[model samples]
Target: MECFRIDESGYTGFDLLNRDQRFQGATAIAIDDEEAARLIREYFPRLQAGELKYRALSRRPGNHPRLLALLAELLRAHKSVTYVCDKRFLLILMFCDYAVEPYYYERGCNFYEDGQNYGMASLLATAGPTLLGKSEFEAMLAAFQRATKEKTPAALKDLVRAAQKTKWRELPEAIGPLAQYAAPECLSAIATEGVTTDAALVVLQSLITRMEVMSDGPYRVEHDQSKNLATYHDLLCRFIGHEEEIELRQSEIASFKFPLKLTEVVQVDSKASPAVQLADVMIGAALEAANVMTGLRADGLDPEKLMPLYAEDQFIHLIPSVDFAEQKQFRRGTQAAEVIDYFAANFGPKK
Candidate 1:
């Protein structure tokens, strides 16, 4: 379950075939023990992002007997020969999802897509800092110096234009039969390393789209009823000490079973505004009734007796019986009814 962020750099490869082999389009590449370690570092960060788990060889470099033996064999076979072991190719190795595929060594050819490919540059661009690569202040300074040398005293706007124009030189040149692959938006260089060309393009596209629809200020909705539910929940917490025990029902998950000690009940409205009052009134009446049910004799209104007012199903209990312990345990449920009734009687519509 351990995670690691690895940095891939400082790896070299040697070829097993001679220059004659390369001329005939034949080449062999092999990695040494040191190079394997470097590949692990490079792929580590990407592996963590994909939620992978693996024991790192570098952590127990001495204990990696199999890896060491493999490297030793390859070294012996290619003694005095060289292979171009491209660690850049190893960058994709970090994306192995062990949960889905456990055999990392024998996994066949890793496929890559030109359009859907994501890389480090794109990751950074979407989640990067305010500034990238060279500092803005430094860019300004260089532009100023170049303008001065040109003897034109360029304006601030013109200097900015020059800087942007300079970035166009980083694009890769088109080559071979696909010479037309030289795209206008192709990324030759980016502020981040180890990112693919297409990934950089995605980041650039996202930036452009975001800039197009930037917002300027805050906005509010005048007729939001969602706020009323929150206030009702708050009132329940105040009356009943079991703030955590009260469960607020949502439209989709409205039906639920209550324990034998609990019941579904309601408070009645006896005041001015019944229809539109957000909080339930019947529950309040039941709470007031519970106080009397407990033999406390406060106006002789038994909240437990009032339980029938809201109970819909026999199994879904809303009120507790009149025993001293039950009364103490169900006091919150009782008070819940009382609070709703008290508030509604003073403010709800006339019965």
Candidate 2:
């Protein structure tokens, strides 16, 4: 595994491969179209310059090489705003998406390719705490409400118990007061300790199912082939409580308003809190999961290959063929480089 170099545009020499050049979770090249062409032509020379390193430091075994390699390439492509903060940065980056989801631990490291694995959330703890699954978290909150009605222990709560204890049939009333009850320690306990109460357990299972649904976004993975569908149907039957025959009603799935053209990609914040963002990330990876899923469905392509993008991970991935780079190049109205210089001039560096 040697280092690779690409002297595109004016970005020549090892500076092209400088650590600073790789931001967030992507590899940035310093070159225009002509330089890009030349580097692509002599790509082997760059490989000879840098190493494709993998340093796995988890308590469990390392990830599969094929899966790990693909993830690495994905990280490189999307690393622009994504940063790695640990010793095994590359290895950890590959696992970040999976690590954030619920039940990841039960499935081991190789669960992304197949959406049927049941315990992806649990498996990720081996890596570290990064994401929180939203739908699952909501389901858990529901259970917490139920538990309050049943007068269960206070510890088995999501921090929103005051409102949750009310007799309101709708969830929002019960959830508001209990928002503060969501302690990290309590969540850690829940993740590590499987539920004893039936209500709580069902909520956990619901979280897992919701993750699959949300993850099926445009460019993200859609593991619903006929075979996968049966498993999915069974899970839905279990999650929804009772098996009313379901069918894909294309007309019923109304179109959403597009902030940008079909040919354009826009980034929208869900306005979710850090905890909520973590929950969504664990459920579907990042905002990119939603974006890719939308993009893929807009066109006609199977999206099972697109990986989930976690928010904390901080990179918005793009397919090389997409026009995102062009949009970035023409982003004159937004807070771009001039803003950075202005900030630097005002405050100075924090050395």
Which candidate should be chosen as best, given lDDT against the real structure?
A: 2
The number of residue pairs in model 2 that clash at the backbone is 59
Instruction: Flag regions of model 1 displaced more than 4 Å.
Output: 1-272, 276-280, 302-311, 314-351
Supply the TM-score for candidate 1: 0.15
lDDT of each: 0.24, 0.26
Let me know the TM-score candidate 2 reaches against the reference structure. 0.18
Compared with the true structure, the alpha-carbon lDDT of candidate 1 equals 0.24
> Considering every candidate listed, which one attains the maximal TM-score?
2
Looking at model 1, report the run of 10 residues with the lowest lDDT sum: 1-10
Q: What lDDT tens digits, residue by residue, belong to model 1 across residues 1-351? A: 111011111111111112221110001112233443443344342333221111232233343343334333332432111111112122211111110111211344221111111232222223222332334323433443333224242433344453343322332110100112221111111111222211111111222122112212211101112332232223222323222233322112121111112111122221221211111112222223333454533453333433433312101111212243433333322222222223333322223
